[model samples]
Target: MTTPRTRMPAAARRTSILVAAAEVFGQRGYAAATTDAIAQLAGISQAYVIRSFGSKEALFIATAEHVLDLVTDAFRTAIAEADDTRRIEPLLGAAYVRLAADRGALVTLLHLFTLGQDPRIGPIARAGFLRILAILREEAGLSMERATAFLGNGMLVSTILGLQLPAESEDPATAELLEATFRENTPLVRELFGGRDLDG
Candidate 1:
């Protein structure tokens, strides 16, 4: 009988592949990203990538999952640091703006929301959004239905706005406009998230 070759740890392999796939998908979009490019970016053979992920769709799902995880982590951090419900929106909005500045992440996020809506990602996406909603509600002491509507709308609006903008618009005026927009919208988010009014 022939001896089998030693396999790399699954966690390490998957992490490396996902990282590479993220870069490729971020740059090229899901439709344009190739396994060959992902493998090359990962410093591994294409066969390895294929063997590990099985298909382009699977790899894209993994990349999307990674991005969602990052978003969840960011929100958790934002909520934790906030002094009150009113601070939640501004902190999260600030995080979103910072994420938008990341070219790779912004591109990847736009692609995911635009075209990567296959059934494969449906459950994962739902779970992630639900988790976020739960957190927002718990932190703000909102009822279930209200939390769902508020967080869901906030995410959709944020994604749409992020997608409509270019990845690297270098005009200072545009930068100022975006900053102003975020500031103006922060209060709206506070209201949606159940922040108490000062005048109440």
Candidate 2:
């Protein structure tokens, strides 16, 4: 006999669907991912997923918002615990790298960023990107140059993971660049990427 499924509370179920949506959307991106796939991943019916999120676009927006929340919260916590203002960038960088361990969310955020041309998602994506920059500049108290550099480095990390370049590339130049880029967070990067051959 099959065991009966335990009913999850509405909030928990919604969260689960979002998590599953992130994973699916991260892999396939916004246009390609479907409610059916999200529902399958979340172990719910497609109709239920629609009822919960109202639509795929709504779900994508929620997922994108969730991604921003994760990034902002990580930076906020790092900033709060930091003693030296100069160390803000490094602390925030480390915190972001740590969050990358949740690969789905990281990739989902990146994917959402690329949807800036979409009428519905574009505004959300632009606003989210600006919010992160604002936190680095305003909240973290980093200068414009510092904030730009920090964001550049973070984007580099995202590109490295997105292309799986750290694990797949065999070029010495690529490896060297990655090494220099992630020199400060090498261990955390390695740990997050699961001992991948980042050495090329």
Candidate 3:
């Protein structure tokens, strides 16, 4: 029932809105970002933004959720399809490394944590993480607690990597060095999973 003309405009507007939100959310963070500013960046009025998205928080939530969805899909697909279980850590590492290249996701995450302890965002982010952990746990046959813990640690390391490195720092030697460090630490992951051969 929708014509291309109508659909095209809607799609364009949505992209414009998201792009504006990413810029504001990246620079000032979620809590500090304002709808007025986002609208200004988008070259639209605040009312127009509110009509499209309910509020600044809603916009941030959409942006964060969008990035998380991509991460979840790419991560699960890459790890699940790989022939070797030993590649899980490195695969996950590579996923985050790729995500870090997306300036929007990195900035969104940095701003998300900066927001004061709110029960709303916490559950959403937590649920997304738990879902990923559940996938890893179910696939890897790891216990719930162990899976969550191990994935938590992995995410922490990935966050640190995202924060410390620039997006353009695409050095094969650096990646190899990190991968080697990950390989060397297989014993630690094994210990975390109740001494299982996760690296196998």
Per-residue lDDT of model 1, residues 1-200, tens digit only = 99997877879888888878877887787878999999998888999888987999888877877877777788778878888876766677666655544445555665666653667766665666667677767765567776665566555546535444322224566445444555655334333322222112
Task: List clash counts for every candidate, in order.
Answer: 0, 0, 0
Full candidate order by lDDT, most accurate first: 2, 1, 3
Indicate whether candidate 1 or candidate 2 has the larger lDDT: 2
- Using lDDT as the measure, the top candidate is 2
Off by more than 4 A, model 2: 1-6, 168-171, 194-200
List candidate 3 stretches off by more than 4 Å.
Answer: 1-12, 113-116, 139-150, 158-162, 165-200
What is the TM-score of each predicted model, taking all chains together?
A: 0.68, 0.89, 0.66
Off by over 4 Å in 1: 1-10, 140-176, 184-200
RMSD versus native structure for model 3 = 9.4
RMSD of each: 9.7, 3.1, 9.4
lDDT tens digits, residue span 1-200, model 3:
86664334877887788877877787777768899998999888899889988977788877777767767777787677667876665666556555644556667765555453667777667766667777677765557776666566665645544444222124666445444544554333223322222112
Candidate ranking under TM-score, highest first, comes to 2, 1, 3
Report the error of model 2 at residue 170, Å: 7.1
TM-score for candidate 2, please give it.
0.89
